[model samples]
Target: MASYECNRDFPVEIIPSSCARHSIKCRKIIVEKIRRDRISNSIEELRTLLQTNQTNQCPEQPSARLEKADILEMAVQFLREQASSKSNESYQSGFSHCLQETLRHLSLHAPLQPAEREQIKRFYVHQRTSMHTRLSTEPRAQFCMPSKRHSTLRVRKSLWRPW
Candidate 1:
């Protein structure tokens, strides 16, 4: 390909010879090597991560040499476990929050007696426990959020009170 070069004072035009094809091929090889190096380095990093996780989980067990496929499999398993635990934690937290809100609102506005409220609280606890046990036995659906995007919004509360 013909190309041009620009200096501070003037523009210079240049043309390529037949060796351009060889040069282009060499560049492609170099680029491919670099890409392969990146992939290998990332795999090594994952291997180390998996080793550390395994060691942490079982200190006395010796770590064996891992193949690339094994490393990838273990990494996938680890990620799934992490995601599942996070999801379960969020679900439990949300349920607890709902229970608290329900109790608070009932205390303020509901005409039910204290004994009835206590009975409802016991029912909530029972449901929470049963759901937790059920979830522990079954694989819950996973919903993944994009790690890169998050909101940090601040809202201004109105001064007017409904109460």
Candidate 2:
């Protein structure tokens, strides 16, 4: 049977031979480098320990945070792919139109804080303007235009419009 030490010390040289060739002071350099490396390694080890402890203490799913992050990232990538794949004029126009509609829908239903509400309002206005521009450029696209009532109504009234 072989015995193994979990925490083994390794010899590390902090000063390079080039420092001696340049006649630079080596002792202080060596001490400082060693200290810096020690502190860095300690911090990394502490972080690993903390992460391990957190995982071990949790009774629920181990990778919930990672999974959520992955899902969000995947959704973003899917949106990007869809946007990038629309090379044709009609596809680009239609995609923008649909995006504007989705944003408008989200603004109506999503629970938003005051600041978030302001941000959403700004985005909605911008998207509406972009939608108008796209519709102006391509008048034949029926689905891209806001309905008569929706186009005339104020934002508040538009919010009340049935889904």
Which structure among the candidates has the greatest lDDT? 1
11-83: candidate 2 lDDT, tens digit per residue: 2342344334334455667889999999767655554543464345443535333333433443344344345
- The per-candidate count of clashes, in order, stands at 0, 0
Point out where model 2 deviates above 4 Å. 1-24, 59-163
TM-score of each: 0.56, 0.23
Give the Å error, residue 20, model 1: 0.7
Residues 62-108 of candidate 1: C-alpha lDDT, one tens digit per residue: 77787988788767766775786787779779978988898889778
Candidate 2 at residue 72, lDDT?
40
User: lDDT for each of the candidates?
Assistant: 0.64, 0.49
Off by over 4 Å in 1: 1-17, 60-62, 105-163
Clashing pairs in 2: none
lDDT (Cα, 0-100) at 80 in candidate 1: 71
